[model samples]
Target chain A: MNRFIILLLIICSVLPVFAADFWLTQILSRSIILGVMALSLTFLTAYLGVVSFAQVTLAGIAGYTIAYFSANTAGIGAELPWVFAVLLALFFSTIAGALVGLIARQSVGIYSIMITLAISMAFFYFTRQNYSVFNGWTGFSGISAPSVMGLDLGAPVVFYYVCLFTGALATLFVVKFSSSPLGLSIQGVRDAARRVRAIGIPTSPVIVSAYAFSGLIAGMAGILNVWHQERVSSFSVGLGPTIDVLIISVIGGMRHPLGAFIGAITYVMIDTFAIDLISRDRFNTVIGLVLLLIVIAAPEGILGILKSVKERIKKIVLN
Target chain B: MKFFFIVFFNGLTLAALYFIAACGFTLIFGLMRTVNMAHGALLLLGAYVGYEVVEITGLWTVGIIAGGLTSAIVGAAIQAYILGRYQGDELRQTLITIAISIIMADLMLWAWGGLTYQISLPEMLLGGVRLPILNVGYSSVRLTLMAMAAVTGILLWLLIAKTKLGIIIRAGVDDREMLQALGFETKKIFVIVFAIGGMLTGMAGVITGSALSIAPGTDMQFLLSSLVVVIVGGMGSIGGAALGALLIGMAEQYGLAYAPTYGVVFTFVIMIAVLAIRPQGLLGRSEK
Candidate 1:
């Protein structure tokens, strides 16, 4: 199963080079960028047992920041470096994320969920109404994509490779972080908060820091998302977007970071094709039903089932 | 002064409805330790049933009763078959309930076509009288809701505080294994508790629908409000849920009347303040 996934990944990574329209390539690129955002969620939820509903809002904050800076009117000057704008936006999002995390850090269990949900809702409404800067519900348009090192990165295929490379780098970072002592401690905190606290691990700071880190990644993805679509709106930070991320993480099983990408691909596939097959209004119904079946039949997700099958085959051979 | 009084009265009315809905959610969470995300969906299910009943039979009381009964039956069956199977594992139970919620919500959307449906209340109950403080048109049905919910709250308090069944439930919440060892059927207790919780939610639904009408996103809105109530009330405390609902209701009402645009912000501010002061909730049991 691992080999098969890897092979598929390789094929997908290399396919655009052979043949593809810019539009189709853009879709794939957007999915990867979304995958990055989902990957950030994977870190907090899968690794840390904190099912934060605020990551998308963090992304929204960052995306709007980027758009505000890059907007032709009353935004950052065209002469001002785009890199500076992206960094500033990311910093803003990280701070916003930290503030939200601080507010939410005190509560555990369902309270945490409510706190995050409230914050997300507030951000969504604030953005939807704040027309002076955010351009209100209509959102900002015509923000030019960044041009780094004289490369026209706006090209779909070029952007796809960029997303692919960045995704690989982020995945590596996540894997390393997961294997580190800090990551193990996060997991420890999740499993037994009292035990971890009793041992003097100072779990709260660790979790809060993870939230910051996760926010940074999500913010970066948000910047990329704005670049990909050249648009940012209130809907990007709403409940639907949050649920989409959750579906990706949960469907892929929150156990591993790779699950994010796997889940993202499956989600994009389902979302892109499933609606066409059925009444468009029933899309949520289909997705919801799929999620129900997954929860019922494969609580550990696809990875767990494959692992079990692999174990069974090995046991049989050994016997 | 009159305007303030009107806002206060409106807030109280909203709070009464919120308390009715949150009562069941808090009870189930308190007993089962399960975060039934589907509770809001179940409420919607009840509203839809009531909508159908009122549309067909044109009897408002019958509709409300039928709605509550339907929710109770469905809640019992799900608890027995799905939630009961995963006793003690809160996370798995939550996931199962969330799945159920998702399916139920989708099915509701499919059935109801995202249209707002109003219950056919009797004219006497639908109209209102002007109070001296304000010329308010309050629904007589909402009055019934307020009265019914208050009575239900008292009955529940008596059940849990003054009866053997309540004793067993309280004891079981503290130590399920001990309750089991004491020859009590904890599973049966869970089913009964879950069904009652569902019935309460159903009652809240029909009442709210009768007051405000039923719509597609109504479940989500009510769920958000119930969550706020549960948080402020602290998990598993019936009185706490009521207090939270009252506070939120009043806060939301004042917010809508005064700020208008910042109603969501008002609820959130209270939530943040509560979370900062008491993370365990105003009424939640101590967590070490």
Candidate 2:
């Protein structure tokens, strides 16, 4: 797994040298950002045994924070330093996620789905309805990427590398944290909450911490996403994007964090190239069918399918 | 004082609509354990079909029947064919239904376009009526809707309490394996529950189409409302659904009227508060 990530990083690092500007900005950067967001859902689902529809809501909270604090086309912008804006965004989003976790701490499976779904939709409606802070439905525009240190993130290649590095760091954090004592406890909670409680370790804090960590990851992606679009709106956190994250996580294989990137790249590929096979208007139909097929045929997603194929090939060769 | 009466009546109308849409959702969840995430799409499909039928036949009653039947068949087919394949795995079933909803929403948008459709009201249902005591004018359709919701609640109650299907459902809710051991066709029972739920959703769709308007995004709106209602009350309990609907519907209308901007927040607060206080909901039975 380590070797595979190293190889993947090597390829990604060199992509800007060979790939077109369009590919760097639109395809790769976008995929990395979406992958990071889906990683949040993947982490919770895999570790906490909780499926959160509010992951994007957490992301949007950060995105909106950046929009409100940073310079904006809308007059409502506070025009804070980009660094401050990003920090505050992360802080607010993490809190929002923790709050969601607290409310839904006792729930799991279908019940968890309901609560998170409602919370996500409520945020969407709130953003659309509350004009003073969110600028109503128009949201904020003309928000450009900021220079970090000496690097101009406005450059296409720079932004691509930025997203790639963010994704890599996020992946490493998950990999490292899962082995930590707290992470093991979170996993234990997933396996059997009643047993964990029987051991006298309070389960709610672990669950809330997991959500907060994912919130931080999602918030990072959300900021990158806002930079990617150069705008944030109600559409960002709406049901469309909420479902998009779920589709990515499920498509990538819900259990693995790295699968999120694979899912995102595949999803973004379909999003961009499906127009070649069908009308642009029917894209949802195509994607929907893809998701439906994945759930029914390969619940384990692309990674699972690859594993099975490898096993079958090995069996045939041995025979 | 007069304005208060209008909002109160408005709240009733909204409650009635929510109750009609949610009872079916709770019914399916109560029996199948599947959340039917595509339920909103089903409701939207019913509204579109009803709109088309009313336009073609020029009969409101036919439109209602046609819409309800279409949703019933489709809902039943979804359960009997697709969802039934993943019995006991609630997560997979929910995921599959979400996919279905996405496909259904896109296809409906293609077929119905993005236009806001309002099923025209019949001649007798038109105009306003004076309410007693308050003597304030209110829409007759809303009154009819309230009456219809009450009737629906009673009919559903009877269906659950009186019919053989009800007995199977009650039995299934308490113990599915036992029901199967008793020689019941569990899959058939599931299909029946989905059909009834779909019918309620369809008829509610038509009613909502006439009362307000139906558009592409209405599905998500109603779906979220149903989720909140079912959560706020109790899952799988009819009385809970009604109570939840009343609370959420009244909260929604009152919020919109009193606090123009933070109305969503008000409804959101109620859900959070209820979840915090009673995770099982107001009338929901706590699970072991």
Candidate 3:
């Protein structure tokens, strides 16, 4: 299975070169960024059993950080080096994630959802209302990716490769971290926090660390997102995008990191194609129906359904 | 002092609307443990329906009733078909309701157009009433809303405190299993509660539509405000909902009046502070 996945990744990496469709490449890169964001959410939902509506807020935080530090079309540009900007973005997101984690630590289930929703809404309004920093609703634009190793990072193919590399790295990091002792303990806490506590593990720190790690992943996605779009807006971090990430995570199957990518791909494809078939106003209706059907019919998501199908086939063949 | 009174009156009026909208939400949450994210959409649908009814009949009261009934029916259908399947899975229910809300919102936009709609008021409630004490006039519509909310609060209290179905609902909230064990058809009781909750939300929607304006995105704003109210007041408690609404409404009015820039920020600050100090809420009991 691992070898097959690696082979598939290699094929996907090079296929963009042969296809060379600008729109397709853009969609793929956007999906990958969204996938990275969804993966961050999957980490919390899968291991911690806590579904947050604030991952996009974290992503927005990083995006705004990059916007603030980078040379941009906006007059108020910091013009810092790309590396420092990214590092600063990651740092701020991590702190924000930790703070959110601490704030949400005590709440469980529905309360957690409400708290995160409240916080995200607050952030959205703050950014939208405060014109001085966020530049109001229009937000900052003209952000371009910096060049590295004599290659123009803003070029389509190069940017695609950058997104692919970053997405893969983030996924691998999640996979590796989930297997680590801390990750296992976090899962243990998810399953039985009291038992884990009795066994001498501090559950709160573990959960906070998970949130921070997820923040780092989301922060990377956020910076990449700004580079891809060449702008950052308050709308990107609003309730809509936050809900989009949740849908993507759930559609892909929150049980695994790969599910995030799969869900993002599906969502992007539907979003891209559905507009062609239906009126613009009715497009969300289609997406909503699809989401409803998926949640009701296949709660485990596309991957879960596929896995179950494979297992059934194996059982039937053996029998 | 007059400025303060004006702010206070505006706050109270807004609080009344919040209380009405949030009561059903809190009741549903208390009884079902499901956060109907579609509650906002339902309210929006009600407002749209009320707008249409008022447009046709030329009577705001008739429009309000029609809107409430329409939403009640839709709410019950959603509960029966979609939400009922996921009994205790709060997350799945939330997602499903979100999907429903999205669908409803889009449909509403497509049907009603994206323009904001305000329900036309009757002639009696059109003008402002002169308040001698504050030496200023207040909108009669807002005062009517406060009266309606108070009446709703009293009626709901009576229903819960005095009626047999209310006892069953209270028992169900306290312990679902025990209520089920008592041989009452708990499912039927839930349906009734959900329907009533939906009716209340719809009624509030029409009132809000008349007082303010109902647009495509207004549902989300209402949802957020009600969620804040519920969280601040303590989920599932009517009195708590009232208290939460008052605090939020006053804070919002005062903030808008004083700070102007950070008006909405004050409500969130209060929420965070309350959550940090008392995670259960101002009136909510700690969940076992």
Put down candidate 3 lDDT per residue, A65-145, tens digits, no spaces. Answer: 899888877666577988999999999998899888988888777888899999989999988897777877888899989
In the range A24-95, model 1's lDDT, one tens digit per residue, is 454577667778888888888777777778999988888888888785543432434788888987898878
lDDT of 3 by residue, B1-288 (tens): 888889999999999999988988988988888898989988998899999999999998899998899889999888887788788788899999999998999888888888988999999999999988777988899999999999999999999999988889899889999889989987777778889889989988999999999998888998999999999989888888999999999999999999999999999999989988988889987887
Per-model chain B TM-scores are: 0.96, 0.98, 0.98
Q: Could you tell which candidate, 1 or 2, scores higher by DockQ?
A: 2
Higher-DockQ candidate of 2 and 3? 3
| Top-scoring candidate (TM-score) | 2
Error of 2 at A29 (Å): 0.5
**DockQ-best of 1 and 3:** 3
Per-prediction TM-score: 0.92, 0.99, 0.98
Q: What is the TM-score of chain A alone in each candidate?
A: 0.89, 0.98, 0.96
**Residue A287 in model 1: lDDT:** 78
Query: On lDDT, who's better, 2 or 3?
Result: 2
Off by over 4 Å in 3: none
Per-residue accuracy of model 2 over A235-314 as CA lDDT, tens digit each: 99999999999999999997678889999999999999999999999999998999999999999998789778999999
